[model samples]
Target: MKLSVVDTERCIGCQSCMFACSRLMGKAGLSRTCIRVRSAGGMERGFVVIVCRACEDPPCAKVCPSGALKAKKGKGVRVDLTKCIGCGNCQDACTIGAIFWDDEADKPMICIHCGYCIKYCPHGVLELAKLEAGHAKR
Candidate 1:
């Protein structure tokens, strides 16, 4: 399954999804969240939900010099922490800025498409979708 933002217009910028994601990772703040909700300048513009679109061929994996970021068939990349060199290549390669940095661990936080954060999105802005025949619904 892949996580997608279906309705950005519905977002109230409550940040409940971000909090839930962080908590699931055994943390207590935004530092560990794979998802982010940021204001689109002001209240009139709603907000933007930044997250992985789960590319079939993720650029982040391609730039990882240590091979720590391995591309999944259709769900993006999985991290092998033991092989990660903290070079920041994966983070820099993510065009959408979905890859988050763990300042303390000096590692990147890639979404696993676990759908844990979806449960907390009060606005129904996020969805866990099943890809069909190499295509995903945005």
Candidate 2:
């Protein structure tokens, strides 16, 4: 599926997306979220939403020594925690800074592309698009 593209221009740096993601997993705060919204050189420049783009060829998956990362139909790369080794290779592989670290578990926090974060974006910065048939390459 299409990644919920973020329009940097529209971002208010509210970090609602980050809160929403963590809450989806029954967590209480931003520390556990796969998505991150932080100020870019102070809030006046606005915020940046760090999340997966559902790459056609995900480097994170290729670098995973344990095969913890898997590409899925209509979604994107989802991490298999059991297989993950907490190597942080995916974190380094991601150019967008989408992969987050759960310091408590010492593992990368990955996005499942569920669109839950979109609902919490007050500035209309994120939107999900459908993946066309045969669009996935990896």
Candidate 3:
């Protein structure tokens, strides 16, 4: 499955997706979640949902000293926790600010494109799409 922001304007900043992401990872909070929803500026300014775009050529993988971040075509980076040195290089290399940190483990949290959180988005701000080759992502 492929994940994408369907409409940020429709978002209510409920953070249901964020919680769902953590739940899928066997957690109860944002600590382990790859998806993030943050207030853009003020409450009236709306919210921004930050998640991996599954870049065709992810820079995070290029700067990863341990090669822990591996880019997948039409999918996001696959993180190898064992190989990861917790150096935060991948986090820094992410231009979209999708890389989330695990404060307890000192590791980066990248999306696996499971689409587990999409179902919890009550307002349809996020969605899962078919991972078709050459298909332009929204």
Candidate 2, 80-121: lDDT as tens digits:
999999989989988878888999989988888888988988
* Model 1 misplaced regions, further than 4 Å: none
Backbone clash total for model 2 is 1
Clashes of each: 0, 1, 0
Q: List the global CA lDDT of all models.
A: 0.88, 0.81, 0.87
Query: 111 in model 3: Cα distance from truth in Å?
Result: 0.9
Ranking 1 against 2 by TM-score, winner: 1
Candidate 2 RMSD computed on C-alpha atoms after optimal superposition onto the true structure: 2.6
Best model number under TM-score: 1
What does the lDDT come to for candidate 2?
A: 0.81
Better of 1 and 2 by lDDT: 1
Q: Which has the better TM-score: candidate 2, or candidate 3?
A: 3
Local accuracy of candidate 3 as per-residue lDDT tens digits, 25-132: 899977788998888899699988899988777899999999888888777889989999999988888888999998988899998898889889898898887665
> lDDT by residue for model 1 over 1-138, one digit each (tens)?
788889999998889999999999999988899988888898688988899888877899999999899987657689999999999998889998999989999999989998999898887999988876766556
Q: Please name the candidate that would achieve the greatest lDDT relative to the true structure.
A: 1
What would you estimate as the lDDT of candidate 1? 0.88
Pairs that collide, model 2: 1-74
